[model samples]
Target: MDSIDLEVLHACDQWLRAGWRCEYVTVVRTWGSSPRPEGATMAIRADGVVVGSVSGGCIEDDLIAAVRENGIVRTAPEVITYGISADEAHRFGLPCGGTIQLVVEPLGAHSRMDELLALAQRRVLTRRTLDLTTGAVELAQGQADEQLRMDGQALVTIHGPRLRMLIIGAGQLSQFLAQIAVGLEYQVTVCDPREEYRASWSLPGVEVVHAMPDDLVLEMKLDSRSAVIALTHDPKLDDLALMEALKTDAFYVGAIGSRANNARRRERLREFDLTEDQIAKLHGPIGLYIGSKTPYEIAVSILAELTAVKNGVALPAQMSVEHGKALAA
Candidate 1:
């Protein structure tokens, strides 16, 4: 789930707790060139205050206007469509005659938003099923592969972390990377056996553990939705973890090092039981070639490559740090 949508849910929870009526809006479907994707959410307070966004801006303005004019009168969830006509598209600032279908539900105690927020905070994947007829909701454990679905009867939405990241160090670079990963909605865990490093690291919303990298790797049981990044240059720390992670279904397994160092690391991994194809999956010289000289910039470069891989974008060879640096040399 997006952090923005989570914030929207949090705001709705607060409003309901304070006895303020609010409407929860979700973008169920989109046609043509819409600004927000399906499953994007927004919350509108009774006084027209809003959090999160379903469109660029104009659609939000219209929704707020309606709420302020008549108040939230609906006792049941309603499906509303915006930008049906070209004129309406232009008025709503939807580009290229885009259309957005939304489920606008009047939120109250029955909304279960507080419970949903708690589950999300706990990093539990949850499915929220809303009965369109009765405004009732049911929550269940959600699968990582599940997507948002809506029928004539109900709306099913998945929430919580859909991706997981394991960073094998508590160094400064690891700290920056972990923080950015959290904002990107990844369930981030940092493992560092070195007590000195772990003692100095205190970032919130990220799980820090005092365990060896390889042990943690096996314990995580990394799946296709998981990523492992080794920032600790120590072979004893990073190499074994990379070895175990490469054997798994992890989507991205990488280590941060120079070209020569990574070559040596690969040679060292050959001493392990990892197959050639599995070792080949390692992304050493980990990030894109962004000329990153600082910790934050390096973190950005690494995440850029990770995002590209996640989206199945095939970047050119020259974009890699090794390739680009070689060309520069």
Candidate 2:
């Protein structure tokens, strides 16, 4: 599954190629609590077909109505604001009287959307700059830490893989996790040195590597945007990979196992050079407590925890399998 941004870009690409007039709308800024972030985007064809979203369904309806009425006749880009008043906020369904600023650009040859889409498909971090007056665009390599910025003359939006996940083991659980993670826009890679497991693995879009987990983890240079999950249930594979992963800035490092096994794993890690703080970062038994008994359900539980961490949501102690089990004891 494509990310929301990718979906919009792809819809624009198709509409443009089909000779349909289209307008690209991006959220440039927002005040108070908005449903979507500043860089969220959507594209509308002249026929009122919309892909992606801005302020959920409310703002999208307005944009679609505008496109149907005016047909995106503007030759240049323009900035528009919505929900400026309490009544307007209520009408637009913005929570807490939120305000949202948008950049509505009529698509044309100068958009350079093809180049942007290609870069995004390649998972390359790209900075796209759009001139507000001329509608001309410029593309350059972007840093992971770069953010969306708008000056009086232009809008610069960063595109590419903002998150990644490395799954240690191409087993059934990894397959389900990779599928969901892809929809979440994670550049997923599943590493398994075992040939038998690697041969049967057939998920598309996820990279399958036949290398040691530890070496793969180091090679990827795991950063804050990265996550590592061990599902192999093999000490030789998971322990080595986690040893290196915990030392890095990967936002989450987890291994699927029982609470007692996790404790044992920590003890074994202490046998190595890992410190207590680093060891504490490990998420063992690895998922939220949702009474998951099947592989797919377990994958959902794991992703729920991963998503909570990614969004910086604080999960109640009883929500976690390990913590809940402990509390029950």
For every candidate structure, what is the RMSD over all alpha carbons to the true structure, in angstroms?
Answer: 3.1, 3.4
lDDT of 2 at 313: 97
Report lDDT (CA) for all predictions. 0.93, 0.91
Q: lDDT per residue, candidate 1, 168-258, as tens digits?
A: 9999999999989998988899999999899988798899999989999999888877999999999999998999999999999999999
Which stretches in model 2 have alpha-carbon errors above 4 Å?
14-20, 170-172, 192-212, 215-223, 247-249, 270-280, 289-297, 313-321
Best by lDDT: 1
lDDT score for residue 303 of model 2: 93
The top-ranked prediction according to TM-score is 1
| Tens digits of per-residue lDDT for model 2, 10-65 | 99888888898999999999999898998999998998999988986999999888
lDDT of 1 at 199: 90
Model 1 regions lying over 4 Å from their true place: 194-210, 218-224, 247-249
